[model samples]
Target: MTRRPTPLKQWRLRAASLALTLPLSLAVAAANKPAQGDYFERIATFPVYHNLAEGEARATETVAEITTASSDGSTLYYTDSPRQRLGLVDIRNPEAPRPAGFLQLEGEPTSVATHRHFILVAVNTSLDYARPDGVLAVFDIRDPRAPKRVASLATGGQPDSVAVSPTGRFAAVAIENERNEDLNKGLLPQFPAGHLNVVDLAGQPADWRIRKVALSGLAKIAGEDPEPEYVSINALDIAAVTLQENNHVVLVDLRRARVLHHFSAGSVDLHGVDIEENDRIQPTASLLGKRREPDAITWVGPLLATANEGDYKDADKVEGGSRGFTLFDPRGKIWHESGASLEQALIRAGHYPESRSENKGIEPEGIASARFGKRQLLFVGSERGNLVAVYDASKPWSPRLEQLLPTGVGPEGLLPIPSRNLLVVSSETDAADDGYRSTLSIYRLGAKRAEYPQIQSDPKQLLPWGALSGMVADRDARKRLYAVPDSYYKASRIFRIDAGRTPALIDGEIELHKGGSSVDYDLEGIAQAGNGDFWLASEGDGKKRPNLLLRTNASGEVLREYALPEAVAAQATSNGFEGVAVTGEGALERVYVAFQREWRNDPAGQVKIGVFNPNNEQWRFFHYPLDQAPDGAWVGLSEITAVDDERFLVLERDNRSGPDAEVKRLYGISIAGVEPQADGTTLPLLRKRLVRDLLPDLAASNGWVPDKVEGVALDTRGELFVVTDNDGVEDASGETRFLRLGRLRP
Candidate 1:
C-alpha cells in the first residue's frame, strides 16, 4: 500500500520538496570554442563512486556532504557519511582531478573545514536521535599522499557545519543535534538543545582546548532548542551560526567562546511566488509572514550572508524561508534580500523546479564567497534546483548574478578555491533506479561565455515554460515561434519564442481556457490557425484521457473541439498525438497529427501519422518507418512540422541519454505523389530522406546528451530550430537546450 504522509511526515516531505526539485540540454553553439570573455564554465566532474576501494561493489552508495580544498587549492577533501569516510582528490592539474585516497573513520563525518596544513572534520557518533554524541577529528595534510589524524576531542552533540579561521588559530562547529522530523512532529524546544563548539587549533590536535558555548535564551522561537545548522568563521575569529529551525542568526567570538550578538533572521513578504505543487508554475501567491529559516551561513567582511533553505515550519502554516538569500550585518540589520527575484531568475534560466515550486522554490542551501584577482565571487547552491548561481559580490552590498552552473542532485557543499580561480561543489543525491551516485563538479572562471543554460525565458517576461513538445513558426515572422508543453505541466500553455536571442528566449506565453474559465490539458502539438487561432493536439494514454484536437484563439479561448474515432482511440497506448502540422488553406486545410509510437494495426517498426480535414469531417492515416533500435534504446517520432505544401519535417530520436544516445535527428517526408489510406484500411508507409543529424548539436556542449528531443520549428528564412524537454526538473538534471540550427537547404 502507498502510505499517505502523516502530518509530521507531510511537513518532512514539504522540507524534502524544498531539497528535491530535480533534472538537461547542452546545445550546438558550444561546438566551437567561445570567444574570450569573463564567465564561468564547468571544467570537470568527479563522481564520488570513483573512489571505491578494491573489491568494493560499484553499487555501494557514497555521498559528498561537505567539501573543502587544501590551502593551495591542489587537494580536495569531502565528508561521505554513507561510507563513514573522508575522500580525497588530487587536483594538481586543475582540469583533471584524480582520487587521492580515503580515510575510513569510526563514525559518520558530517562536515569538514581546511586551515593551513590541517583539515578538521566533525564526526557524528550518535546511537540514536535523542542521545546525540559526536567528536572532532583533526587530520594533518602537509603531504597530499599521506593524511594522518593526530587529534580527537569529544563534542557535546551531533555536529553538522564546520568552519576554520583565516589565521588558522581557531575553528568552529555548529553542533546541530538535528531533530528527526519523524519524532514529536519535529517540534522544537526538545531536551538537550544543541550548542556551538570553539576549538583552539594552535595546540596539538588531540590536546586542543574545546569550548562548548551555549546559545539558548537568544532566539524568539524555541530558545532552548538552539540547533545551529551552519557556522562560518572570518579573519577576526568571529563565527556566524544559523539557528535554522529557530529562524535566527547568532554571532560568537571564537576566542572568548561567548555570544556577541543575536537576532531574528526576520521575515519578508514575497510576491509573484508559486505556492501550490499542482504540477504547474504559477506565480500568483503571496507569503506575508514567512520566516527566513536560513540554513547556510557565510561571512563577508563583518557581515553575514545566508542561504535560506527554510527546512522546517515554525508557525501554524507550512511556510518557512520563502526562497532566496539575504545579506545582513553582524547586528542582524538586513543589508539586502533577494525576495522573489532569486527564484524568478531561476525560472528565467529554465532551471526552475516546478515540482518543488510549493516548497521553498529551489531551496538555496549552501553558500561560499571568495576573492580572485580583482573581483570577489559568491556561489549559492540551490539543493532542489541542482545548480549553483555565480555572482560578482565585490560590492558586498549589491551582488550581480553572473551565471547558473549545473551540478549533480542535491548540491550541499560549496568550496571556492580563489587561489586557483576554481570552485568546487558536492552533491549528495543518490538515485537507486539508475545507479546514479553522488558527484563532485569543478568550475573555473576564465575568459569565456558561461557554458550553461543554453536557453532561458526573458527575465523581463518571466514566462514559465518547459517540457516544450511541439513547435510551429509564425506565419509572418520567422523569429517568432510558438510551442506547447507535454503532460509535465498542469497549466495548458502556449509559449512564444524569439530565436534571435543568444540562447533563444521564451518571449511570452498564453494560457488556454474553455468557456471563459481557465482550463488545463496535456498539450502536445500546436500549429498556427488561419484566422489567428491555434490548432492544438492534446495526447491520450489509452487508460484515461482520450486524444483531443482543439481550435483556440490567440487568447486561448476554445473555439472548436474534436475527438478521435473509437477505432483510432482504441489503438493508442499512451503514445497519442505528439505533434501537429497543417497544409493547404482555409476550407481545404489538412491537419496532420503524429502518433509517437506504433499503433495496434501498424507494423512493428512503423507508426501512423493521422491526417484530418475540417471540410470533410474525416480522418486518414499514413505510416512512417522507424529506425532500428540499438541495444536498450527505442527510436520514435516526437515532432512533425509542415515544411511546405507537400513536405513535412519530422523529429526522430532514441530513448537513451548521455553516451548511450545513438540517434537524435530530423527526417523529411513528402506526400506529393502518395495517397493516404482511407479511414479503416492498411496504412501506406511513407519514405524518409535524411534532413539533419542532431547528434553533433547535442554533443557540442560536452555535457550529457538528453533523451527528449521534442520540439522543432522553421523560421520564414528557412532557418531550423530545436528544443529538448527537461521533464520539469523531476528526477532529471533540469537543463533546457534550445538550438538554432541556422538555415537548412530544403
Candidate 2:
C-alpha cells in the first residue's frame, strides 16, 4: 500500500464508492429485467359448473338455455333465460368447462350472437304479447361470455331477432309488429306489422345510427304486389338481396350507409340467418359435380337459418311445417335447410315438455354433504322446488338418486351427519307468509334404494321446526340442533336428537343471549386437531348487528363468548357474517369468519374473515376480495381443517332469495403460515393462500343458492364432507346432491 491509508479513512472511501455504484447498478438492472414470478398462476379451482341434464327438473317459471360458441373449438358463451346474464365457460377442455365470471346485460334478452370478441343481445321490453318494444343491446365480448355492455339503443318496434356484422361494427335487428289493440278494451292488437332496424355501431360509444327504416318498401318483390302493410320481416339480411322483390336476402351496406341488396326465399318465410366470410366457406364443387354445383356456388358463409313458425290460422297445422330453417350462404345463397315443426322444436328444446304438470322440476339452490360409514352422500336444496334431493356419491360423477323428501315452506340449506345417519334441512319462508317463520326438517338415513342397491338414500322420516335465517348442529355435549328463532328474536333453540333411533329429538332445548341470524361451529371441518376442543363463531347484524365468537363445549353449551373487536365488528351488517373457520391448534388456533355485507360502500367491499386465538382470546379482522356479492343474506362456513398445518380449507355457502333463485357458489379458502406447536399457547397466525370456487360453469349454476353450510366433517380417507340445510320439500327433480371435495396431497 502506497501511504497505507488509516483503517477508518479507507472504510469511509469504500462506503462512499459502494453507495454511488449501487444506485446505477440497480437502475440498469431494473431497466433490462423482464417480469418475474407467477402471482396470477397459483389460483385454486374446483367444480363450480355442473351441466348434467339427465336428472334435471323444471321448478320455476323460467328455464335454463345452454348456448355455446367457440374459438378453436373453445366454448365462449354460456347463459340462462330468465336472468339473461352471460358467463364465460373456459371450454378449452370441452368436457370440463370452467366459469370465469358473469356477463352483465341491460334487460331480459331474447337472442344472442358472438363474434371474435363482440356479443349482441336483442332485448324486448314489452312483456305484453300485443305490444312490441324493440331494443338492441351491444356488448364487447372479446373476453368471451363475460361481455361488457358497451352501447344500448331503443328500436321503435319490438326486436324478435338480432345479428352482428362480420367486422362486428354493425348490428341487425328484426323488429316484429305490435299486435293492433283496442285502446279502450285493452285487447290484442290486430293487423300487426313488422320491420327491420339496422344499427351502425362501428365507432366507440356506438349510438343507433340508422334510427328507423320501413320494411314494407324493402320487402316489395319485383313481380309480386307490395302488400299495404309488412305483416312481418322475420328474415332481414344485408347480403345478396337485390333492390327488386325476387331477392329475399336484403343486404345493407353499413359502411356505404344504405340498403345494398335484397334476396328472395322463393315462397318461404325466413326465421334465422347467419353470415360467413369467404374464407370460411366449404368447397361445394367437391361434394357435387361441377355441372350441378356451379363456380362461386352457395357456401356456408355466415349461415343464417330462419325457423318458420307457420301461420297461426291453422291450429292443427304441424307447427313443425312452418318451423323449417333457411340456411344462408356466404355467397348470399339459400343453400341448406333443416328443422321440424315449431311445436316439435319447442319440445326438443325442453321449452314444452311432454307433460308440464307431471314434470317434477327442481330449482337447485345449493348442495352440501355428510358421511355415513365409508359412504359420502350429497344433499341438494331447491328454493323454488320447495324440496330437497339426496344423491349417493359412493361413486364420483355417477351420483345415484337416493331420496326425494319434502321440507317446510322454502327449503334453502341441507345438512347431513352420516355418523348418526341424520340429515337436517332449513327453509326460508316466503315474505308474504304472516309469521316470517322458517323451518328445519330432520331426517334419517334409511335402507339403500332397490335400483341402486349400493347407494344409501336417506329415509322420509322428518322432524320440522320453526326458526329464523340460520341453523347449526350443536357441538356441545347435548349434540342438539341450534337455530335462530326469527329476525327480531335473539333466542336460539337447542333440540337433542336421540343417537339410537333416526336422530329424533330426545332432549328439550337451550337458549342463548346472543340475538342474530346465524351461527357456525369451528369443529365442523375436515381434519380434527390434536386438542379435543373446537371453536364456534356467531354473527349478528353489523352496524345494527352484533358479531361474537364463542368457545363452546362439545354439547353446544357456551363456555366463553367473546365480542368481536371493533375492527371486525365494523364490517358487520344487518345480515351479519355468514360463515366461520378456525385454523391451527393449541396456542396457535385462529378463527376466520365471513361477513355478508351485500350493500357495502364499495364494490370491492369484501366478505369479512376475522381471525381469533383461543389461547389468548385475542382477535384481529382481515378481508378477502371476492369477485361478486353473496346471492343471499345468509352465509355458511365449514371448519378450518388444514391440508397441512400451514394450509387449511374453509367452505362457504352463498345465500338465496327463494327456491327458484339461481344457486350461488361454495368457496374453498387456503391458509398459509402458522404452524402447530407442542404447547397449545401461542395463537395461530395465518395468511390467505388461495380461493377455489366450486359449482357448475353455466349461468344457471347460480340456481344453487347455498343457505347455511353447517356440517363439515372428514373420514379417515381424507375426503371432506359438507352439509347444507334444505328449507323443506323435495326439489322438482325429487333429488338433492351433497357435494364432497377430495383433498389433494401436497
Candidate 3:
C-alpha cells in the first residue's frame, strides 16, 4: 500500500510541479484573461423575485440556492428553501432567460439533480436535529411548468446533496444529519449519525428502492457521526461524498452499495495570505497544517477537486478552513493544492473579502466540471467573494486558471451547460434593504475575453486594492493615472494605474507617510500639481474628522495640512470634500474642493465648491446647481477635474444602483465670470452645462449598474476616465469598473 504524502511533502511536490509546468503567462492570466480565445461573458441577470407566485408580496425573500438543468439543458430548476418551492426557468433563449414558474414543495428542498426525464430532489423534513428525516422526491420533468411527483422515497436522514449516475440506472443522495451550531459550539458526534441513500432508478418510479449505506467508522476524526455535505457521481457509477465537518472524503461503489475507499481530506500549509481582519489586505501571513474541510466536490476524469471551505471550528477557535482548494488522485495522493493562489487572484481583481480573512478568505464552497468541445473546464465559486473562477483542466495535474466571472452576493449554485456553451450561477443572499437580491446570472462562451475585471492589478506584483474614491491623470504622462481610497481602508496609499493596457493595470503604489510612520486618512481625492506634488482631499464627518486638504510631495510624504474655516466646517455633514482639483502655477495656483452634498447652511439642490489660494491662505466659495434626483435617492458630486484655468468638469451621480440608478453624469462648470464669497456669505450659483451622461456607459456592461461612480478625470491627451467604488468589498459585490472614454470636446 502507498503511504499518503505528508503536508510538507505535498507542498514541496506541488511547488516543484508548478515550477516545471506552469508558464509565466498562465500564472498572470489566472485572475484575468488575454485578448484572445473563447471566454464566458455575462449575457443576462434574472432576479429570483420575478418567479414569486401570484399575489405574493414582492418584499418576501426568495433565494436560488442549488440549481439543476433538464436533460436537454433548456430548463433550469432551483431550490428556494426560504419559500419551500422549486423555481423553474426557461433558458431556450440563453441571452434572455425567463422565469417559467415555481412549484410548492412539501419540505425544504436542499438539492436537485436530473436524469433523463426525471428530476431527483432531496427534501429535508426533519423536525429537529436529533431526529433526522428526509425524502428523495422523484418528478417527471417532461412538462417543467407542472412537474408531477411520481414517487417519494424515505431517505432515513436529512439530505443535503443529490446526484444521478451517468448510466441513468442509479441516483445518490448525501443524507447529512446537520448539527445545530448553537448547541455546545456545534461539537461533532451528535445523537443520530448521517449516511448515504442510494436510489435504484430501474423500472417504474414507484418501484424505486432506497438503500442505506452506513458511513460510520470511515472518518479518522469523527467516526460515530458523519455529516455528508456534497455528492458527485463519475462515469463509472462511483459516488464521491464530502463529509465537511469530519474533514474527510469517501468514495462509494453505487453498484455494490458499499464503501470503496476513504481518506482524510487532509490539511494544507497556506503562505502569503491575509489572515487577520484589519480592514487591510496585506498577504504576508502563514497558516501551516490547516485542515481542508472540503464543502463541495466534483470529479475531473479520474481526479477529484474539493472546495476547502472549512466550516468547522474547534473549541480553541482554530478553524479547519485551509483558505484554498485541493485536487486528489484515486489513491488519496495530493495532485495539486491551491494554497494562496485563488485568494491572491481575487485580491488582484479587487474581490478579496477582507472581512472574512479571520474565518475563510472568499470561502470556496461550490465546484463544477464540464467539457466544452475539447477543452475540459473546472469552475470554482467563491461564496464571500461573489465570483466564479474558471480553469482549464486539460492537464489534470496542472490546471491553468483561465477566467473569473462576477456573480451576486452569495453564489451557491454553479451549473455548466456545454451543449449550449453557457454557464449559470445562482446567488442565495437576498436582502432587499441592502440593495442585493438573489439572482441567477447567465453567461455564454463566445467572447474573445472576459468583460469583467475591467481593472486589475498586475499579477506579477500583486497588491490588493479597492474603494476607488477619486482619480486624477498625471500632469505629463497621458497613460498614467493616480487614485486614492476612502475611509474603507486602514492606511491611505496612492495607486498608480497604467491606462495603456486593455484592462488597465495597477502596477505601483505610494503609501502616504507622515512623521516617519504610515498615516490613515480618509483620502477621497488627488490632483497632481505642475510642480509634481499632489493636493489630497480628505472627507470628514461633521464631528470627529474635520474637512481638510493636504499637500504631499511626489513621494507621498505629507508636507502640509490645511483645514477648512471653522464656521464653514461646523455646518458640514458626513458627505464633505469629495473631489479636488488644481489650476495655474506658483503664486497664481489655486486648489478647488467639491463638497458632495448640501451643507446644513446651504440651500436644497445646491452644493458648495471651495477654492483656496495657497500663497495668501484665503478661501472663497461658489455654489454648483444640482440635478433633480430620483425618489428615495439623493444626487451629489463625486469628482472634480480641471478642464483649464477657467473651465472644469465635475462627476455627479445618485445613490441608487442597478435598475433604479439615475443622474450619473459629467457637468461642466466655469469660474470665468462668477465671483466667489467668503464664509457666512451668500455664494454665487455657477451656471452648468451638460458634458456627458454616464448612464449608458454604466449599463453597457450588461450587468447591474453600480451607484458610486466616484472618480473621473481627463488625461494629458484629453481622453476621459471613470471608476467606481466597491466599498472595500464590505456588504457589497467587490467589482471595480475602470472605463476609458474617448477625448473630451471643449
Candidate 4:
C-alpha cells in the first residue's frame, strides 16, 4: 500500500483540487500570503502545571513534548519526559484550552500516536545510553481523564517518534538507540543499531501484530548507529522514517513490514549564514558542504518532508547541520531544500538565536503537514527560535510561507488538525525559577490576521538581530530609532530601526568598539545625545565591572566615559543601570539612569534612580517606589527616559514571561522644584503617575508577553518607543518586540 513516487526531478504534482479558494496559480506567489478567511489565532495558553496533583511540587519542571489529537479533535495527549507521565488537554472550545489530567508511568514517555480509541505511547526504559530498552504501550482513552494502560509490548531500542496511519490499521515507531554524547566526544558507530517498529492493529493492542525492520547497512556515514529519529505514516499506509544521526531517510511498506527504499539525506554548501557562538548573530558568514542532518519527518502528499535539525555525525568535518528543511522523493532524490531562506526569514523577524552561532543557528527540528479546507499546509518548528513557520503547500512544487507563530521554549512537537482547522505546538522547555511552566500553544484558523513579526530586519539587508534591550528614537526622523543589544553577544551594537515599516525593520548594526575590538559591556539603556552620538548605560553584574555611562559617536566608537562615584560603584550589584536618558542642555544638561531591582542600603519597596550632571560629574538619586511582588517573582524598573524637562517616563516590569507576565507599564514623574540632597541615600522620593499600561499592546500581537521590557524612549516627535530583551534566545521565545507607542498625551 505504498504511493512511493519516482525520482524528485521526474515526478510532477498535479494541480491541487481547484476547489481551493485561491487558484493554484496565484497561491504559488503568496509569501505567507495574507490569510483570507479565519487565520490561526492564539486564543488560549495552558501551562502543563495544571496536570500536577495537589501533593506534587507545583513548582517542579514539566513539559508537553510529543503530542497527538483525538480523532474528534476535542482532546490532546502529550508526553512529559521530566515527569515521566502522559498528559491530557481539553480543547473542545478551541478558544480556551485547559489541562485535563496526567497518567504516571514507570519510564519516560517519548512519543504518542492515536489510533481509533487507543493512544499508543513509546516509553523508554533504558538504564544507560549503551543499553536501551523500550515498550509500545496501548492505552484506552475512552475516559481521557483516566486513561487505562491496557497492553504493553517490548521493543529492543529507544523510540523517538511515532505516527498512526490514516487507515487506522497501522502504526510506526522509530526505535532510535540514540548515542551517548559524553562517550568518545559523541563520535558515532555505536552499534546495536536502531530500526522501525511496525504494528498492525486489527483490534485491541493485545491482539495486534508487530515487526522490527532493521535500518542498518543503509548509509555510509555511521551506518552502524542507525539512529532513527522520526516517523510519519501517510494515508496509503506507507511510513517514512528519518535516521538523523546517520544522515539518511527511509521509506517502508507497512502492509508488508519491509523497507521499500533508503538513501542519504545528502549535504549542501550553505551561504550567507551566521557561523559563530560568541553571543552575536552576524548572518553574512558562509559554510561549505554542511550535511542535512534532519530530525522530524512528515509525509507531504506522495513526497516526504524533513526538518534539517543539522545534527551532524560525520567525524571528518568540524561543522554539521543544515539550517532548514528538505523534501525528498521515494528515490531519495532531493526535491527542494530551504537552505538559508528559513534562517534568513528568522533574522528579519528579530528571532535569530545568536547564542547558537557555534552550533546550528535556528534548528528546524519538527515538521507536520495537513489538509485544511482547500489548502494543504506544512508547519516547521524551530527548536531554538521558539516559533513555527507555516506554509501553504497546496501546490507541491511551489510553497509559500504564511506566517510565524510563537511558542514557548523549545517547541519539540508540531500537530496539525485539519478537521478543526487548528494547529498545536508542544514546547518542551520548563522554567522552575521563573514560575513560567512549559506550555501548549493552540492556534485555530479563522478570519484573523497573523499578528507576529511586529519587528524584523529589512528584507533587502536581512541584518541578523535579536537580544534587544535599550531603545531610542531618532531626534529628528519621525520613524527612525536605534536599539541596543544585551550581554548575549560579546559585541556591543546599536541597531538602526525604521519603525515606519509594517514589521519594523532593523537596517544594520553600528558596532561599539574600544581600540578597534568590540567593547565588553552589558548595555541595557541608550539615549540619543543629539550630537551624532548616544549615551549608553552599562549594567555591571558587580562581579565583572562597575556600572558606568559612556558616550559614543555615530560609528559606535567610544568617545567619553562617566564612571560612577566610588561610593555608588561599591554599592552596585548585578542589577545596576537598566535605562538612561538625556535631559536639559549645555551647562544645565543632565543624564538620568534607572537602577534595576533593589540593592543594599535601601528601604523595602524603594530603589534608587541616579541623576548625573555631566558638567560637574556629580550624582544624586531619588527613591523610586516598588510595587507588591508577584507570588514568587521580583519586580524592577527596566527603563527610564525624560519625556520633557518637567516630565520623565519610567518602565516598571516583572521578571516573568508568557502567561506569568503581569506588570509592564509606563509611569510618569516630575522634578519640578524638587530639592536634591548631596547624600545619595538622603534624596527625596517622588510619587509616580500612571501614563500607559503596556500589557494591551503586548497582547494585541497574539504572542507571549516577554518579561524584559528593558527600553523606553520619548522621541522628539512626542512619540514613545519600547523594546524587549529576548535573552539571546536562551530559554526564550527569541521574539523582540519594537513597539511605537504613538505620541503620549501628557
Candidate 5:
C-alpha cells in the first residue's frame, strides 16, 4: 500500500494489459474458464477436506495469517493473501458450507477476531520494517445476520491481536514492537517499545470510541487491578515462557486505562528457557541423584522450549531469536526464570538421562491456554516442527506434553471451540521458501481417555483433519468453518466446511477490482439481496481510483458490473480499496464506498468516494480533499449504513499521521438528493477527475501522499463496516493498509 511516485514498472504493466484486447468471444471464453493444464489452471475439484501430503504443500515467500468468524456458529470468514481481501461461507450444514461474501482490506491483516456483534482485525503495516504501524478495526454484527464495522482505531507498530471486552465497552490491542534503533535511525522516531493500546469504545449501541495507552505505564501498576478490569489484557506474561522478542505480546487493561504488561520471550540476541520432563525411574539415578528422587514422575510439562527468532545464525540478520513459549501460573505468575537464565541452567545441567535423543526439537511461535471439557490445556504452535504440541496445564507450575498434531507449514494461530470439540490451526508459510502455501488445519479431538493422571495427558486421537483452499483471512462461525482464499490480484473465494463432512465452494470468485489486498471478515458485512442477489462494495482502488460494485445471484453468478466514478477511483491509491455497505428501502436503496487515498508528493492528495442508487441505477461521487482535513489520509473505510433517511454514517481513517504528517481524522458524511431511473437502477456516469485534487479535507491534512485504504461492509442494524489493507510489502513504510472506519451513528 506504500505510494512510491507510481513506479514505471507498474504503469507499464497496466498500460500493457490495457492495450491488449482479444476478440469478444475469446475474451469471454478466457474469463469463463482458465486453460486446462495451465499452471494457473482452473479445476472443478469437488472441495475435499483432508490432510495434504507433506510434499504437496505450496510454499510462499511470506505467509500472512488468516482470521474468520460465523453466525449460526456455521459460517466462517477467510482471506487470500495474494488476492488481498476477505470471503465468507455458510457452514451451518457442514457438508455444504455456502459461499457468503468477500470483503476487501487496505493492506494485509495479521490477526482477526470476532464476537457476536462485531469482527475485530489487526493488520500489519506495509511489509517494510522501517515503516511500522497497523490499524485496528471493528465491525457490527447485531444481525449475526449481516455484519459491518461501526468504529476503528490506528496503532503504531504491527498490530498482533485485538480483544473486545465482555461488555463491548472497549477493545484491547497487542502491538508488536519490532522497530529497532538500527532500522529506524533515519525513519521517523522509533516507536517506544512495542506496547499495548486501548480503544475506549462508546456504549454497545454507539460507534467505536478510539483511544490508546502505553505498556510501560501499564506494567508500572499491574498489581492494583482485577483480572478482567483492564481495557485489554496481555497474555504474553504466560506467553513469555515461550515467545521471542520480535514476537512479544502486549496486554492492555481497558477498564483501568493502562497496560498490564509486555512480555518479550525471544529476541535477536538472547535464547529463552527450555524445560524437560521424565517419568521412568532409572537405576542410574542412584549414581548422581541427590536427596530429591525424580523417579516417581509419570509425566512432564514443556519437555523442551526456547524463545528466540529462528534465524539467529543467519548473516545480515537484523534480529536474533528462536521461538518458544514460557510458563505461568493460573493467577498469571511467571513460573520460570528469564529465558537467559533458563538457557544457561539447561546448558550447565547437561542432558537428563531420561531424555530421548530422537525427539524432534521445536521453536514454538504461538502459545495458547484454554479449558476444554474439564481439562486445562496449553497449546504451542511451532514454527520449526510446523506442529501443534498439546500439554496438560491442569497444574501450570508443571505442564506435561500430551499429544502433537501435525500441521501445514509454520503453524501460528490456534483457535479451539470446545463447544464443538474443534481445533482450528492457522499456518504461516515461510517467507524465504516457495511451495509452502498457508493453510487452516481443522482437527476434531476424539473422546477423552480416563487412564492418565491428567485429563489432557491421556492419549487422544485427532481425526478428520482438513486443509482449506488458499490461505485464511478471518474465520467466523458457531458450528461450521468458513474460509476465504489468499490471492494478490483477484477477488477472494469463499468456502464452507460442515463438521464431519467435506467442504463446499459456495461461490465462484468475489471480484474486488484491480488491487484488492488485505481483507476483514465481519458478520453483518454480508447480506442477502432480492431473489438471492447479493451486493458488495469494492472500496475503490488503492491508487485513488474508482472500484467495482459487484452484484451476483445466490449461486455466485455475476448479474451486473457497476462501474464506479473516477472521483471514488482516485481516492483509493495503491492500497486498493475495501469496505462496502448497503442501506435504504427497496427502490431508494443506497450503497456507500469509503475512499482511502494514497500519499503522493502532490500537496493535495485526496479521497473521493461513490454512492450508488441501485433503484435508479445512478451514481453520485463524494470528494474528500486532503487540503481541508486535519490528517486527510482516510485509509480503511468499513461501513456506510443509514441512521435514518437523509442522514448517513461515513467511517474514515482517524489517527495520528505517520513520520511525514500529523493528526488523523475519522468522521461521518451526510447524504442528500435522491434520483430514480426508468429501469429502477442507479448507475453512475463515467466522469474523470484529478485524483490529487478531489477531496479538500484530504489535501490539507497529510500533505498529499497516496494512502492505501481497504475493507467495507454494512451491518444488519444499518451500520457500516470498514477495514484497511496492510500489504506487508517489504521495506515500505505504513502498512499497505490505510484506515478502517465503521459508521454506526447517523
Candidate 6:
C-alpha cells in the first residue's frame, strides 16, 4: 500500500513549492493533491559517449538530440547530428540502461520517431539555405538488436520534426527550409517558404507518398518564410506545428493534407525577470513585448502546449523568448501561461543560467505530453538550464508544476512512455573537455515524492540565489543552519536554512553591507559566533586582493576585517582562505582559517592553517598534509566545521568531476594540546585522521559526481551537512547536491 504524506509532510511540500517560486495556482494545486499520488523520479543517466564503439576514443564529440522510444518501450533511439548516426539504448531495465550500439545514417538525423516496428528518422541532407532537401528514412527494428534499412522517402524540404498519426494512417513532417544566420543577419524571407508534408503510411513503407501542404502567407511576421520547427499529431488526425523563427502556430488536418488553422504565436511583456549578465541574479529587470517564438509543441488532451525557446532578435533589439511555456486551445486562446515563474523556479533550484540572462532565461525548448493511467503529464525541457520541468496536466486548463528533474547540458528532446511509466530526455551539447557529455536521462513514475531541489528559498520573498559555498549551523537551533554564496554574485549574503525538512528550505537571507553600501567578497567559508554573529573567510585573487578574515553582526553588517599578517600575506596565492571556524569564548576564543593550497614558502603536499587569537591579536600557523591528487588534478581544502572546542572537521576534495574524481573526503584535526609556529617559517605539521569518505554518498545520486564539495556543518544534535558549488552554472551542470551525513563523531 502506498503511504500518504503526513499533514506535516504535506505542509512542508506545499511550503517547498512556494519556496521554489512556482505559480500560485500551481503551488495550491500541487499541495492539494494526495501526497501518495503519481510522480516521476529520475532512475538513471546514460551518457552518449558510452554508446561509442568499444575501442573508439571516448573524447570524440557525440550528442543525443531528439529521441524516441520503441512501441514496446523496450529500446530508445536518438539522433546524433554531429556523427550522422542514430544511437540506441536498451532500457528493458529502466534503472540500468545499456548501450545497444548505433546505426550510421546517410545525413544528419534531425529528428526521430517510432511506429510499430519501424524507426522513422528525418535526415537533413540540405546543401544550403536556398537549396534545402531531406529524407524520411525508415528502419525495421523488429529484431530489436539489429535494425535494417527498409525504405526512404523524400521529404518536401529539410524536415525538422516528424510525427505519426494515432491511427497510423499518415505521418506529418515539418519541412523547415531553415535560413542561414550569416546571410543578411538571418533576416526572414530568405527564399523558398516552408510547408508541411503529409505522408500516407498505409500499406508498406515503399508505397508511401508525400503530399505538400502550403504554409506560406499564414503568419504576421516573416509570412513568406514559414520555418516550421516542431510538430505533434493528436488523436483526431490533427497536427499542431510551431514555426519558431516566424513566431507562429499552425494546425493541419493530416487526413486532408491541408492547413486547417494558423495563428501568430504572439508576444509577452515579462516582468520580475533578470535581464542582465552582470554576475548577479536580480529579478528586477523587465522586457516589454518579447516575442514568444515557440520551438516545440505538444497536444495535451484537446489543448496544445508550446515551449517558447526564442532564437532571434530584430534590428530594433527586440529579443525573442518569453522565458517559459504556454498552454493554448485549438483556436489559439491562451488557457495557461508559465510567464516568469519557471525561470524563477530554476533560480531557486540553482539551475538558472545567469550568463544567458541577457538573451533567454532557462529557454524552455522541448515539450512532450503523455497519459499515465488517469493522469496526464507534461514535460518541458530547458535548453540552457539543463533540466526538465514536469507538470500534472490532468487539468489541461490549469496545469500544476510538480517537479524539476536534472538533465545533461542543453536538453532538446522529451519523450514519455506511459505504458512503461518512463520519460526520457536527450541533451544536445557535447563538450568533452568541460566534463559535460551529451546524455539521455531516464525517469520513472511512482508513488515516491521528488528527491531534488534539496534546498530552495521562499517564494513570497522571491529570493534569487546560487553558488552556495560555506555552511555553519546555529548553536541553539536544532535544524537551523547558515550558508554563503561565493563570488558568483555581486552581493554577498548569508542564508538561513531549515535543515529539518526532507528537502531543506532557505527561509531567509542577510546581505552583507558596510555603511549603507553593499560589499562583495569571494567568501568561501563561514562560522557562527556564540553571540549569533558570523566570521567569514574571503579568498584572495593573488593579484590585487589579499586573504582576510571578517567579522559580521547578526544583521549582516561588517564590524571588522583582519588581513593576514604582512609577512604571511606575501606568500599567499589565488587559492587561499577556503574555510573558517571559531572555538572557545571571550579572551580564550580562537579563529581557525584553512588555506586551500600550498603557499609560496610552504613545502609541497602541505597547506598552511592560520590560527588567530582574539585576545592577543596575534597569528600562528600550522601545516596540514595534503593527499596526492590524480594526474592533471589538484587536491585542496574546501571547508572547515567546528565539532567542539578541541576538534574540527575539514573537507578535502580534488578539482575533478564525474568519473575522473577521486578525493572527496573529510579529515579530523585536534588542537587540544598542540602548539603552532609563530610564522610560516618551519610551521608545525598537524596530525590528521580520516573522518569519512564522501565519494560513495555523492555517487548514489545516479548522476555525475560534482567536484566542489565546498560546504560542511555540524548541528547541535550531531547531524552533519554538506553542499557543492556549481561554478554559477557557467560551463557546468548547475547541480548542487546538498547532502546530510546523519550523526557523526569527530
lDDT (tens digit, per residue) of candidate 3 on 470-553: 999999998899999998889889999999996899999999999989888898899999999999999998889988899999
Tens digit per residue, CA lDDT, model 6, 262-327: 788788778889888889888887888888999999988767899998787676774846898888
Which residue segments of model 4 deviate by more than 4 Å? 1-35, 127-131, 143-146, 316-318, 434-436, 514-518, 530-532, 699-703
lDDT of each: 0.81, 0.38, 0.87, 0.80, 0.38, 0.86
lDDT of 2 by residue, 249-367 (tens): 45444444354444444333322211111211111111110001000011011232322212211122211122233344322344443222222222111122112112111223334
By lDDT, is 5 or 6 better?
Answer: 6
Pick by lDDT: 2 or 6, better one: 6
Best by lDDT: 3
Query: Against the hidden reference, what TM-scores do the models get?
Result: 0.88, 0.33, 0.94, 0.92, 0.39, 0.94
Cα RMSD (Å) per model?
A: 9.2, 26.8, 5.3, 4.7, 27.2, 7.2
Q: Candidate 2, which segments miss by more than 4 Å at Cα? A: 1-531, 543-545, 567-571, 598-605, 629-641, 652-693, 697-711, 728-737, 742-746
lDDT of 2 at 24: 9
Summed over model 5, clashes come to: 166
Error of 6 at 296 (Å): 0.3
Ranking by TM-score: 3, 6, 4, 1, 5, 2
- Tens digits of per-residue lDDT, candidate 1, 444-552, equal 7784677778778887766777778788888788689898888888768898888777767788888888877877788888888666789999988888998888889
Candidate 6, after superposition: displacement of residue 250 in Å? 0.9
Q: The CA-based lDDT of model 5 is what?
A: 0.38
For model 1, give the 10-residue run with minimal summed lDDT. 21-30
Q: What lDDT tens digits, residue by residue, belong to model 5 across residues 357-422?
A: 112123445555555554556666645445565666554444555555545555566665556555
**Model 6 CA lDDT for position 119:** 84
The C-alpha stretches of model 6 lying farther than 4 A from their native spots are 1-32, 35-37
